[model samples]
Target: MELFGQSGNFVLINIVSGNIDFDLRDDNPAPCENIWVGNSSTAPTDGECI
Candidate 1:
């Protein structure tokens, strides 16, 4: 899909089954700081910030 922000910051997470399409605008020129992709029902326990 698409996401927009005033601070030009964003994050994306894919849990199960799907595809992510990111469209960044030149006006913001910002990139996603963190991204998580997995297929686990439990949370991450490796000291991650999940």
Candidate 2:
């Protein structure tokens, strides 16, 4: 997942909360932008990527 001018590459696992956490990576790279990933059940108030 490569976002424009942003690195969205990473694996998500053992996620217990809606916070951002990555367990593996090629390097401790800079985080991606404040992007948003929402579903149909997602609310607008929950803002930012979760």
Question: lDDT (CA) for every model shown?
Answer: 0.32, 0.33
| Candidate 1 lDDT | 0.32
Least well predicted 10-residue stretch by lDDT in candidate 2: 39-48
Candidate 2 lDDT, 1-50, residue by residue in tens: 33344444333432333334432212323454433333232212231233
Off by over 4 Å in 1: 1-30, 39-50
Best by lDDT: 2
lDDT of 2 at 30: 41
Q: Model 2 — TM-score against the truth?
A: 0.17
lDDT of 2 at 33: 41
lDDT of 1 by residue, 1-50 (tens): 12344343333443432224322222332353334344242332221322
